[model samples]
Target: MTHTITGSAKLLARVRRIKGQAAALEGSLGEGTECMAVLQQIAAIRGAVNGLMLEVLEGHIREHLGPDASAAQRAEDTEAVVAALRSYLK
Candidate 1:
């Protein structure tokens, strides 16, 4: 979304942090870290990713599906969001 572009710096920072988390997980595996710590790292990565998704998705809904949109437009946007969610969940 255009708003996301305007706010790209913040989103990019989150992505970078998530990438770092994944890299740390890889390093832990390479170094034979214990299973519990590895699992915790994986969970941290998942939470970061989920948080990023929520921010983007909320922005999209607010910008595209707001009250000013026509009924048909809202319906279409809602469908598109549902499809995206379905794919993401899979």
Candidate 2:
């Protein structure tokens, strides 16, 4: 049930940005930033990651689970997408 991306460059770029955000969070901790500021950075990183996930999920639904696709196929894709989303949320 691996959902394939439709080669959306924008989505790829968002993922790269999320990677950088994660690194920035690590750097903030390494530099001993204030507790509040560090927590804010972490919150921002989480939001960015969620945004990337939502964008990709929307694209998967629109492209892979089209209106004409069978209910079973749509359900399978939905399950895959939800599994990925749940893992990320954790």
Candidate 3:
């Protein structure tokens, strides 16, 4: 939680940027913008979301699965994380 608290401002900024991107996408659609333009905005949103996921996952690994963790435990945690990420991205 301390990691989150300390990084709240940065995280919120990223979220706000994502929100702005979403709003832009909505506006583009409403205005009948080009399909490629809307698609580009969607791609940008996906990249932003992925970046946020990476940050959060890194924090989880550092905090929940510390450096001292056993190799087997680390492998298990890594597998679970990868599976969850695949499900989410899909």
Candidate 4:
């Protein structure tokens, strides 16, 4: 029970960090930073966002959508994950 709360806290921390990174990237651009450096920061932030998404999706699959899940539940989880991946790729 407490673990769930702690896990959510950790996730929130990551999301906040990612938001900070995005803001920093914007600030760098507005500051007339070099194009290559700005692009690198953007790529780094995008990777971090993708990594966070992957972690959350994997956690869902392992904890809530395994053999213990009902057919309907598994199907829904699968669809959600697929949609997430599709959006990530696009």
- Tell me the tens digit of each residue's lDDT in model 1 across 1-90: 686998799999999999999999999999999999999999999999999999999988998899878899999999999999999889
Estimated TM-score for each candidate: 0.95, 0.77, 0.79, 0.83
For candidate 2, write residues 1-90 as lDDT tens digits: 134345566777888888888898899889998999989888988898778777767767887688977999989988987888788777
Report residue 12 deviation for candidate 2 (angstroms).
Answer: 2.1
Better of 2 and 3 by lDDT: 3
> Candidate 1, TM-score vs. the true structure?
0.95
lDDT of 3 by residue, 1-90 (tens): 466777889989999999999999999999999999999999999999999888877876886578877888889888988897899878
| Candidate 1: residue 31 Cα off by (Å) | 0.7
Candidate 3 regions with alpha-carbon error over 4 angstroms: 68-83
lDDT (Cα, 0-100) at 8 in candidate 4: 90
Q: lDDT per residue, candidate 4, 1-90, as tens digits?
A: 232455898778888989999999989988999999999999989888887887777777776687888999889878988897898789
**Index of the highest-TM-score prediction:** 1
TM-score preference between candidates 3 and 4, better one:
4
* Ranking of all candidate structures by their lDDT, best first: 1, 3, 4, 2
Q: Candidate 2 has what TM-score? A: 0.77
Which parts of model 4 are misplaced by more than 4 Å? 1-6
